[model samples]
Target: QITALDSDTNVHVYAASKWKTIELTSQMNVSTKTPYSNGIKFTWQQSYERGNQYCLAISAWRPFTSLCQARAADNYISGSTEATNHRRPAVVLMGCTDHHSYTLPERPHVIVHVAVWTRQGGPPLARAVVRPFKKPRVPRLQPGQLLTLEPSSGGRALARLRLRRGAKRLFVVAVACGANLKLQILSSDGSRVASVAGGQGALHLKLRQNQPSALKMVMTTNPPGAARTLLLAASTSAKGLPLPRLPRNTVVSTIKASCNNVTLQWKSASGNPNYCIMLQEDFNPGGHHIRALAQCDWEDVLQHPVGYLISQCNPGAMKARRQRYLVGHLLPAHAYIATILVQHPITRHVLALKPTYFKTKEDCSL
Candidate 1:
């Protein structure tokens, strides 16, 4: 029998003097070290019974191919299929998390899309990751620089685009060949700004920058497989050039910083009073290559839960000033970045404020 661990007494240990030498052969005395905690120690014991053997195997997967939230230990392989079924796909997402932090983790709804496909005689397609999409920080368009947009023909029933500029007028013109196409210009929070539904003819819509910094576009075509074209063109006037196109009181005016707390001050947003505060470590501002992966999230970067603090501005109303929030559980001698998410009280639209960062001193306490 095979015995391991010092406490195991399943088999008795033998001494060199107790061994019997073959008929006429001579045997030398052998001694081995006893098993201990530090290193692998083996003892030479003679027994007539054979026991089970133990072994280990190593595996290596493609970089970033491993899922962060695997429920169990199992190996999966993708075969030659153009697309995998979403209901029972090879990769399943559970949630986002930090690196095994002891604190409570935030559960963000991260939607997974795009399936990795395989071909018969061609090269394999690159894997695509699906993560929550954020609004891009686009600069204002220059004078005489016309913005043009043309949609693609695909199976998607809805498409989204964001336009960020301070300009005089924005226009969207759509030409439907024969299908019923619907166009909706929405605010950041999925609120409708301008909508048009029709059978044919050119639908022209205009928007201004002084209204909202960014807008979302949603297009739907009826009869499923009808052909359609959408053109988005924008222009700026010299009269509205000096001031930003966004409405007044749309962003936080200033941020008050302290040793262990921060106060975000802002003029009452014109339409909405609901707001949110989000904080995550911004140690690597210029390098965001790693975070582009769907698995990497605020928790992973912050080494803790995503400090997403949500609160209303005022009871029944939406106004709060000098809002002070205690920045707790921050690492000493570290830098962190914070941002604000405000929703329009009336239109139910949303907007994000400028991001700000602060550094903590040693032994910082709230």
Candidate 2:
């Protein structure tokens, strides 16, 4: 099952069994001894230009009541990861089952299904492959210990660590260079505990534990075989650690509005050096717009923003003050919401500021 929270904090639950009927642009197969025996790797090369964006979805065939699927994009930047200007091909690795346990019933073979399409609505041009391999030995992680992995082209790595009893929280910090990084944490039963995607970022994971438990960490890089560096560290506490924080007093006020553009101004508190502004049409139910904005995060806002800009907060200046920005090429007389995001100078963590509401002017010439 998949559960998601919208901007209004509405809960959404999705069944895992419905993936069997979804149409796909492409599909492939892989063999495995048992449902939990080996890991399956999928690689695809994008035939389109690097600037174009595409969505990639992967799922395994399940004859029973449910299916396991994972989705990714070529240009996806998680809230925990810093946004980058470079683009890379999409790559992913999947185990036989979603559960962390190896006690599942055995299966002779597994079929893998892949779907690739452009964001603008057509089938994408790409080449893909599917293969199976033995699970590599994972290194045990000691408390507060940091580990680094450098994988060559078309390679993968794993690490194992035990979450001590009475420790109900886990924090993971990952830094990647030269390739897009994907991280997954799985329990001993093969069930996923938590996962995050980014080129570089940190994530906090919470799990209730009554006794000591073991976990497996999986890291993969995009472009299948691109050589990359991944620095991983795990701990239980966040006190005194340099992490991302939301900028305070981030409120946007409209300076000017035209038929197709809007000028906005907002003040930044001290220490906020960079900002990302996103504008999207307001299509939510009436009266819930502000509530939605108040509850949403960077990931939710970036999903379908119509206009986006990243700029220095106060370029060449050392003091905190107001900054002006313009979001152009919008529809006339359309209601929209603008959200501000602040990036930390050291951790590269991105957090959302309070969102502002506005509307474009009606076209006078009509």
Candidate 3:
């Protein structure tokens, strides 16, 4: 008898006689081999883009069941690597005995084959189930926020999910092959709410609820592919909690050079909680000959003093403007310039001020 099995999709078929398996395998073109004692076994794994075809075949066995008696359904291996190729077919074979009586107690001879084919590029896919143990307090989706999927190696058509809370829209996007996005919506009861497919792979879903909305992303490949579901969490109420706090006004108030050490000070503005202070040596007022010297963050400051000091500006050399902050951190025996800057905390944009040059004691020497 002939039979067919889908190893990739976790589908199997078995018949008592050989002819049924041969007929089924012939139509499917499932590459299959038959063993007299063990029957037929099928196995496959791979994903193909549009306009690709895979084939399998098994036709040696005789007919026992009618050729058109096979049933088709969504194999459980949906949303899997084997399903990425889209539409596919599987075939197998079985052994038959002359007398339908007590048949020889031997393994049914059978062959199995499977193949995947596609027409247009497959659609973007996603997981089909999501379960959150802890509900969000006040779930809200924000723009530019990142969404991730767990166990994403199985050819699921989603990488990240972006949200436009005001628009009440969710963008389902692909990570690996993310192109040609479309929008889709589904009901809370896990039913086909709405779907759109096209050259785009993004989806914009309307919010069905006002409160904290929780739902899983259900994924479907083009065809002959698997389906999957993923959990989606749209609550970023406490996000951006760890963002770096920038400095406001970066002013060079004082620059003192004693031996090889240099101390620089600046003023802080409104929103900046911290500051980045860099001291450069070989400083040129407008030239690029200066190299970075001492660098530090406000958190590393010994105290919340109003001034910052950069020691060892030139290692052991005594230079004039040559030892200064890029904004002009320099001190000369008779001429020195200091530059100040003010930065925005959130924007990270820098506002600069002209450098103030001061003349040192005319009699000081290294």
Candidate 4:
């Protein structure tokens, strides 16, 4: 299940049997596991150019403190990690570059580790679900405002949130134990952006916002009895979370050049879900002049990525790739110096290894 939250997105894998998201990772459970899980291969597209590094997590959790506790847990035993009140998937997929393949990890037959590159996002900023014998006035939450909620009739609460710039998706969720409640998302203009009513119960919706927006949450419901304590929370996705970086020493194993075509090969890293290879004739390196184009400007790294030159998935890395980039005929017998950049699929960072220098033969061919 892909829950796109603004520019960020949440990739949730479910067992074929239940077909629902996990509890804590998603809040679809507290502590439960299916008897059997499907093990066929599942494939998903990871486009680094589309800001692949912009995915974060959001959830419907109580107190939001439980999430912190779950993260602070020690590496659980593969068989069953007692990290939280429940069991979690043993293997979580952080990510892999385009060069690497992502394989699900399982604990023998006991459990399947949920694939999580990293659970970086946290819950909402605050919770104001209130329950009081007497009803009181409720006001809409303002942008960038944090209001601590007190118990009152039809208790009122507000949580200010800001979406990341260039965000493409937004996820909103609100849940109250009782019925007859309303959840509304207000935009910066103070107009109602989205609301959850009509017995829809909890508010769970993924919204689309291209630019950064300020939002406030307003929840209003019937006054609760003193005995009943209201509980609810909300959160949004963000970009620039901490993520692993691609390894170094990304040398082009072999560079074979025909009069026209040039084939470059390299090995794939383990944690990388995909790879991107960029090539350019200019961008001189050092020496006399320029040697091989091994590095690019920092700003121009991820800009205008030409995509991976090639991709071949088999048992082996299949590092060897042939590029039929002939300008028509062949055999110029000229020393050509070119610069290349390999992209980290997840982070979109560029790795410029030693430049590859190849020359064409003197002979001519058609």
Candidate 5:
């Protein structure tokens, strides 16, 4: 039994040849004030067992209830792992704050639950440590500087990087060797700015002064191996390289229109460039529509696009020198605007071409 919200429960079982069962319960009074002011860290380690492995489950919650059924709500955080020969340790980090707003309370209390079991009915031997520690200082990053991050024992690394002031655009490049990497960039207020997952890639970001003056970089590697390294670099100018010229005199025309689909054809550019087609809902396609779309970031356009496609075209090999794209799964009788864009093969920068406006047919199914 557990009565207190702020308490640690550890269960241990000795190794045995045959199946056995043991149970223990304890209760404590709830404390009004939490002792762990900074944060709490949970660590579990187990010895290797040849025939069987231990499965561990750990969770933390707040605002305790009397009924045991109320513990199912993991409002704070939870983690689980299976202890095997390759992976022998499991760790969980919890902060003393509300999950919705992430704000620290004047007095905080939390309940930590840990459970362990084995498949073969063999006794599992494990140890758990729960302690509170002060927050660690995060290192800062500067522009035009390269930072190398070594993989941690827990397979994640986090750091804070500052953006250059008065720059209209910023580019971030990341490369990982011998491992898969997932990188996420967040603003100061915890809002996501950009995220990329691959072995190597670059992210383009539009900047406003003092809006998101600082960014947090979260990098994680697969397998939790020790030999992985992530190289990160930021710059205002893309290594003194100029962006590719936007495609000129591009034309788009509608070939067929239906209640839920639209077929369009556009003439390819002279140089046979790689391009992307985007469809967006437009209630007002006026003089300022193209200007507004041009000002939006590429990531912003992807959020609410009705249809999108990317491909390369070779005008020299085609008879009509026109590419066809079918935009489907649209609402009936809805107005939409289609825009063409040419993208750089290496840097991933995109420039908008001409846009065409059209509307879907009315619903005929009665």
Candidate 6:
């Protein structure tokens, strides 16, 4: 019987007195200290009529490896004839006497995550992660540099290389960069599967994603730097998704900023009903900072009892400046970044402008 003991039952007291002459038998109850330094005592009181015999075994069992409870296996053994089956055999020990443990061999499981980038593809190029179940280290991406088989879910991005499903897997080609960069691929467990080579061109890495795999990209920095973007794209439909229409007559004009407050001024396009101005600071040449300081918006043609201001330039149209709003305060000396965005009043199509730049006084800076 597994009896739970409290502090009142001194471990040393029971071992010193009642259990001093324990004659263990198969019928003798075995009391353990909860496998650690428990102060509780196990009173294996022996009856004079019964002989004592006990079978005590100390063994460890792992449903999953690691405290994270995420590792499927511990190593990458060569693929055997049974690679098709996902369940990798586990190593277990029997009759363990002293603190039993098991050492997992390399490549214990056959699960892999495959990231593919396709270009006029035949067979999808593959780069198997050298180490499975670990996070991959991603290097700083140059303006035009690309990596083969990048993992991403689709979204609007400038100069982004999209991945396509090839005959066997998805494929992506990295854009070439001239300088040496370091990249590491990690699996779910904190292990490295692949590392960057010293070549200027792009290198391909493959993962087998027959099953769902969760991975993250990590990079080491020489000099301190802010967080960079990691691309993850969702599968696009068979017929290509409609591309956003190119914006025309993109203009940059001045806006007003008082302390932390900002007011933007802009002219509407022929059929523009609503507009969005995304603000991002272009102070640093190597990086772009995105943060909204304030926004001004209004609908075309008065709809409700809300006080409406008509545009002087266009009849029956609401003025742009009349819709201005003060969002929140900015830090003193911080720059105010602005962009002009316009959308078709009826079509709801968005027209993004080239990012604009400005600065706030030190009193209103963040």
- Measured against the true structure, the TM-scores of the candidates, in listed sequence, are 0.27, 0.31, 0.22, 0.24, 0.30, 0.23
lDDT of each: 0.39, 0.52, 0.31, 0.39, 0.51, 0.32
Q: Which stretches of candidate 4 lie over 4 Å from their true place?
A: 1-248, 282-331
Model 5 Cα lDDT, one tens digit per residue, 1-366: 535456676666687554454343212122324345443332233224444544433434322221122223323233433223222222222222211112123222333443333434333223232223335667676676656676677677777777555566666655444455677889989998877764312223333334367889887765466335655666566552223233234557888788888887776543344567776677774436422123125535554443543233222224446677788887888888887665544555444555788888887472
Candidate 3 TM-score over all chains jointly:
0.22
Off by over 4 Å in 1: 1-256, 285-326, 346-349, 363-366
Relative to the true structure, candidate 6 reaches a TM of: 0.23
Leading candidate by lDDT: 2
Better of 1 and 3 by TM-score: 1
Name the best candidate (by TM-score): 2
User: After best superposition, candidate 1 residue 299: deviation in angstroms?
Assistant: 18
Q: What is the C-alpha RMSD of each candidate to the true structure, in Å?
A: 25.6, 27.0, 20.2, 30.9, 19.8, 20.5
Ranking by lDDT: 2, 5, 4, 1, 6, 3
Candidate 6 C-alpha lDDT tens digits along 91-141: 221121121121223321333222111122112122122123333344332
C-alpha displacement of 21 in model 6, angstroms?
88
Model 5 ranges with Cα > 4 A deviation? 1-133, 200-211, 240-366
For model 2, how does the per-residue alpha-carbon lDDT over 1-366 read when each residue is reduced to its tens digit? 545566545656676531223243343223334445444333333333445454444434411111111323322455434334223222232223221122223331444344444434344323233333334456776656657676655646678888766787666655444445677888889888777764322333434444247888887766555545555667776432233333345567887788888888777634544666766677752445422122223444455443543332323134746777777888887788776666556554455555777777887474
**What's the true lDDT of residue 298 in model 2?**
49
Kindly list the per-residue Cα lDDT of model 3 for residues 178-248, writing each as its tens digit: 22223343444555445654331222233343322443344433321222322222332322312221122
Off by over 4 Å in 6: 1-249, 280-328, 364-366
Give lDDT: candidate 3, residue 76. 32
Ranking by TM-score: 2, 5, 1, 4, 6, 3
Ten contiguous residues minimizing lDDT sum, candidate 3: 123-132
Model 4 has a clash total of: 29
